[model samples]
Target: MARGRKLDIEFCGFGDGWEADNKEKPESGPKETLPPPQHCLVMQREKRRGKPVTLAGEFFLSKEEEKALLGRVKKMLGCGGTLKEGWLEVQGDKAVALRHTLEAEGFRFKK
Candidate 1:
């Protein structure tokens, strides 16, 4: 019943044994089928300093797919962009060009 610095503690528990399988593990997760790019949306915007930017949205895609697509588009256009809120926001007035690229990639350009 002494209220000194609370430094003493005791606990007991059981954990799963440390034995781990050494065999190569197969990948997990069912293959995710993303909707065709034609199901996506495209738009344009003016950001800070009146910078023109293009955005492609409405993608029924996983985060990995989105990142991969975004990187491919950015590299294809030789520009920069960030993936936000499941959308790809690219810098510059490249909406038209982006739309063409998307179309070539089997994406519909609906803006």
Candidate 2:
């Protein structure tokens, strides 16, 4: 529906937006080749139901990106985790390890 472009003839309303080819493409390569990251990650210790849980806070990402990042975090930590209210909660006090992992993923963080 953009620039009078026909939806039927275009790839629209999906992961990539309409007129995607017209947009500038992002540089693609190994992760380490990227710059100072696109995320500001924060980690903290929290409690729910009187049980300790580690919270990795406030990732500015869309739903799909958040889900993918959460999955990777969980898998890397080898522990159970969930996303809540735009926060990522991993089981136990995993703040230290979480910080390292996030940094490896090119995320910038502060204590």
Candidate 3:
């Protein structure tokens, strides 16, 4: 069960000159475009405590971009991974698959 109540209220007005400060201004110029970074990423496999892990290195991504890319890779590969210092470590030997996936995402790899 619920109860409802009604109350009478008058208009609520802001103080003077509010519209002048709150008005939206149009942008003046077009945003400048920048080229993508040139990072020759590499994928290698390493053994950690009797387990295999794939290390993708040489990424030039910001912290937020690294986290997002790591999440996307984990989802696409159906594996768990983490972002390390300049490396993305996935819980498996997924170098080849990771290469293919990264290539699709406009990433280049070093031999």
lDDT of 2 at 73: 93
Can you rank all candidates by TM-score, best first?
A: 3, 1, 2
Please give, for residues 3-44, the per-residue lDDT of candidate 1 as tens digits: 776755344233446455797877555535567653757675
* lDDT rank order: 3, 2, 1
For candidate 1, the 10 contiguous residues with the lowest summed lDDT are: 9-18
Q: List the residue pairs that clash in candidate 1.
A: 37-107, 38-107, 38-108
* Reference-based TM-score of each model: 0.62, 0.62, 0.65
Give every collision pair in model 3: none
What TM-score would candidate 2 get against the native? 0.62
lDDT of 3: 0.77
lDDT string for model 3 (1-111, tens) is 346855544454555444556678775455332222366788889999999999987676766777878888999999999987668899988888888887877777777
Which stretch of 10 consecutive residues in model 2 shows the poorest summed lDDT? 27-36
Model 1 clashes, total count? 3
Residue 92 lDDT (model 3) = 88
Question: lDDT: which candidate is best?
Answer: 3
All models, RMSD in angstroms: 8.1, 12.3, 11.1
Candidate 2 residues 1-111, lDDT tens each?
579765684444565543546777774433322233755667789798888899876766666777888999999999999888667899988888988888888789874
